[model samples]
Target chain A: MNNFDVTVIGGGPAGLAAAIKACDEGARVLLIEREERLGGMLKQCIHDGFGLSRFGERLAGPEYVERFMDKLSEKTVDVRLLTFVTRIEKTAEGFCVVTVSRDGLERISTKTIVLATGCRERTAKQVFIHGTRPAGVFTAGTAQHFTNRLGVMPTKKCVILGSGDIGLIMARRLTLEGAKVLGVYEINPTPSGLTRNIHQCLHDYDIPLYLSHTVTRVFGADRLEAVEICEVDESYKPIESTKVRVDCDALIVSVGLIPENELAESVGVELDSHTKGPVCDCQLMTSVDGIFSCGNALHVNDLVDFVSASGELAGLSAAHYAKKAQCKVNIKIGNEFLYLVPQQLDLNADNSRVTFYFRSKAVREKSLLRLTVDGQEVFKRVYPFLRPPEMQQLVLNMDKFAVQNGSDVRFSIEVAE
Target chain B: MKSFNCIGCPKGCLLCVEEENGEFTVTGNTCENGKRFAISEMTEPKRTICSTVKTVFEDAPVLPVKVSSDIPKDRIFDVMREINAVLLDKRIDRGDTVIENVLGLGVDVISTSDILNRK
Candidate 1:
């Protein structure tokens, strides 16, 4: 029965930052990781284009995470590796986390908990890709693990089923590793990856990207041999007449990522239908008091910088957590936004310098995002263009809005006339 | 006019470049980096690639490495060949060069991770 002031789960970039920040705030912190090593997905993401905002340099994923690992080494935080959290129970004092590791079952009590459990990729079965169970089908993240971490090539000639950023990067990675990436087939008309990734990873390597096309079926029993591709309509239904079979050894799926929240759900945390994560407050605290959510557990963030920023905030808030009544007000949004983080605001706590992350529902030119309180515009910002793939972040003085517990705090986006 | 997205930053501003007798005029750039990127794309394009190399240690099978600077885009596979040929047996720290003056491009391939040295 170990006791701690704060316990940070998952040793990814988010959890690492949270542990460091909590330790810096003079709180006794403990970090638990299920893997043999830390760094999480960053270890497999051995590509550049990370740390541009935080470090002001284009660093590889290992390099970006190593900086945080170095900072965490100087702090006095207890780290447990190869440990898996089985359950989290709410206690009268705070929380009791049950974990199983090489040493066996152990329960730790903490005043507050920060959930930094990252997201998981949508698999082939999850996306409704009907196919024979084959050996060559893998998610983009799985393929990345095989190549970057394990040094094993997962495909020889493969067809990618989605245009997500990881899939785009893999197209170039496999090419550099002497594998032939036939083409990337995205079900949507618009590419799902960042514009820069489409250029640097695909265009630079002469990898073709076919939009509005999807792999409806995969053929192979022992190993993946070929795949059935078809042109999809606006409703994403396959147009039967447009079906074509292509020979390939593998199918890499990069459809989407879903936030891992089973532990949060076990603790009775309410989730937002849009973001598919815990409905959090301005401080990144979940609906369940004393339990904070950040990083991909809060929402699927496109950039790691925002993930670390949210983790730092959650860590600081959890470090100062006390049992008290909360005054919460829901934050409403218009139909123009795909989703927004921090679905609610706590009037009882500090509201100054609250950060919001959001994405537009569609591509729009000359758009304006407005924040209104009680039908009066409190803040507004103009953008030249907004895309769904790129999430936006903004920091505002929320205390200036004079929002009460029952006040209407709404965020809306409108295309400029 | 040739239009393309700038890889300068995540903003991904759409840059339009026009060529007029060896002089290029670039528009729609938010910063000077985008302008320079467009100019380089029109001429000799260069890119930085980060990849892993095989190592002798069983604990860490591969070590991550990257070019010290941007190399010519066409020489990527050529550089990969040189990187693949190396079978590193020493524990090198980050910024330690794996290959010096690789392919005479005046850039060294350096290790980007110090995983072997981590205790």
Candidate 2:
């Protein structure tokens, strides 16, 4: 009487891969997509640089996602497009997912649910750019959509704020379309984007990047006319005397991205403060049993290859969940890490070969990561250098660590002097 | 010696290429891709460009396009011009060539998405 064995709640790279893997594992899967398109944000992201690790080819976003869409077509999974899940109720035997679409409302019951809800971009308002409400200010994602998907020039002359990856890519995209980008202003001392991005997207194009600088105010009534810029101190407070004005038609901001998890929160899933996403174990299972999370819903990932890897792991876990009893163990990490995925480990499950994704809190040179179980050093790896923007994935055979219930498994970083 | 960060991936390796006695050696690269990149970069740099093209479709105003192969780094602007000149009157599928042998570079400009064919 169940509608499906697995219900995937997104259509992005993560959800698509999760559903595909679940179906391949002989489970009846249902993929619900709120958007009309199945590829999610990748549809608007036409720039190449995707699938380097997975496919070993520099593919554009659309082309990278097309491979998954092609495989999804052959599966027996039910595809729901332009549908919205209103609420989820924990039933006696399983969970009830109530959805609404153009036709009407429908309820489906499933044993397991996978949340692959991607993320949202932070807007100018979120960053406190005060001024008149103008039409020229757009998030980097919106600008990319306008230019790549809709074939519209968002701005003729623009000033970009924030040195994130999206903003840098759009700078080049806008310039190629004959727009003049004045310069990219970032408040942080170091750029927030990947090194390859800063080099290829900004440096190769000769776009100037100003560090320790920020845009304070937008100066226009209807359209963007000019913006007030200033230098910030060590505390990130603006230096009042260092104010400057730059005139431009638009302000493209790529401040940051926040994981979308309202639905997960509604279900009372525990969220990690550092990642702003659901707390998951080695199998990607959430705090609530029968509910799993992957991709950006678990945490923002730097590469789509890792996103697919997590999705596949979650899908496989969901399919074989009923096989054994899951015993959870919290894996502790030091403050030197920005965040770590798989916050816990399932001792009862296969402890061999667990992949954990993490990033350094800041730039660290000649750093060594120490993994200890019960006060005994289990593993250690040295990194020549680590940056916050680049996420590193480490695969370990937990069996060798010999960690068990109540075992103090901790991860800490140290500078190799 | 000339230094350039490898653009192969997000892991930006500070690559230094030194040509001593006509023998080229690349240092600080983490992988083989970076090594090849250094050699090619030192010899003749090549680049690939991705942009949008104007289309007649109402629902989709513009379609994403990219060169089928890499071209000389200097010809990026020229390749962009060739792609911009075309106003696609017919709906083309993803990977479909919009311009064949564009500017006699033997590289075709292909649509990156099937968004235009939806209508």
Candidate 3:
């Protein structure tokens, strides 16, 4: 049996960040990762566009993770690679984390816990694509990990479904690996990925992007031989005569990503159906006291940088909880948005500046993002464009709107289109 | 009728162009960018080629590389031939300039994938 002041699960950006923050607060933290390496998905993501705020430098995923890992080593933080935590049970005092590694089954007790299991890619089975059971089909992330990370292309002639970030990234990846990408089909009229990715990956490669289109059927008995694509109406229903057949050996699907919250659910934490993550206030804590969560495990983040930032909040909260800290007030979500973090309010807590993370329902062009409390607008900003691909983060100083008038302070983002 | 689709955006606007005896006419576009797109698609097809060449880099057997120019769609094979013929020496790090001013297209092929040292 092992024990620590703080215990963090899943050694991705969130876990690593939380562990580092806890250690920074002079807390003995036990960090566990199920993977053989410290870096999580960041390891396989060899692309840049990470670490703009945290490091003030744009870096690839691995490089961003290396920074925190180096700090963790300097702080002498204990991390167990390939250590899997199977169960977490809350006791009268704190919680017990049961884990199993190559050594054997082990249990650890901690004052506070943070879950950062991250997310997994949505597959063909989840989306229900009409296709034959073929060998050449794969998820875009799986294919990327295989070829880009493992040096093995899944197939030669490929047709990608979903113009998601992963799908777009793989279109460029597979094309470079001596494979012919027939086309990328998206059911939506607009791509579900970042704009820059579409230009740099698909347009640059001349890989046809069929928007408002979908793969109606997948042909081939044993291996993927071809695909039938058809255009869809505004209602997302397929048009009859718009069918086009493309011969391809493989099909890659990047439908979307969903948070891994089996552990979160097992702990009886309240989940938001929109984000498919835990519903909390602004502190990033879960419904269960002393148990916090962040990263893709909380919500599927479009950027790794945001995930790290979110993790920092979870880490800070965990440290405070270990020391038995409390906050007098809590901020709740308002409207046109889903939810906030840190479900409880601590009146005695001194942290004034608060960062609110949220997501929008649809894409908005040229709108004002406003924050209000009890029908009074406190903070507002105008933007040219707002996208769901990018999570919206707003930093508000409670000192700016600190008041004794309202007992319930609601903080939600409203679009003034 | 000059009804062409703008492959520029996911919107995929169906632009119509009417040429009365070699003159120019256009319609069916939502934005001005789509206007430029229709003119270009009807006149010439353009695309940017992003692919990696042979690399002697350390860790990564394959490095991410992209073309510098939006080459004419027909010149894809030609540009690819030029790219395939070259050998990129090892020690090329991520974001390193692999090929500069490729094909006078004012674009340079860059390394997007990282190669790490074993030590």
Interface RMSD, per-candidate values to 1 decimal: 0.7, 1.0, 6.4
Work out candidate 2's RMSD over C-alphas.
Answer: 1.6
lDDT of 1 by residue, A239-312 (tens): 99999999999999999999999999998999999999999999999989899999998899888888889989
List the DockQ of the predictions in order: 0.81, 0.81, 0.10
**Which lDDT tens digits does candidate 2 get at residues A1-417?**
437889999998999999999999999899999988898888888899899999999899988988888889889889999999989899876689999999799999998899999889989988967778878999999999889888889999999999999999999999888999999999999999988888888887899999999999999889999999999999888899999999999999999889999999999999999999999988899998989999888898878889889889989888776734777889999999999988999888786889999999999999999999998998999999889989999999997787878889999999976
- Please report the candidate that would top lDDT against the real structure: 1
| Model 1 chain A: ten consecutive residues of lowest lDDT | A122-131
lDDT at position B118, candidate 3? 21
lDDT of model 1 at residue B11? 93
**Candidate 1 residue-wise lDDT at A104:** 100
Question: How many Å off is the CA of A53 in candidate 1?
Answer: 0.7
Q: lDDT (CA) for every model shown?
A: 0.93, 0.90, 0.74
Expressed as tens digits, the lDDT of each residue in A215-259 for candidate 3 is: 888898999889888899999998989998889999899999888
State how far residue B56 of model 1 sits from its true place (Å).
Answer: 1.1
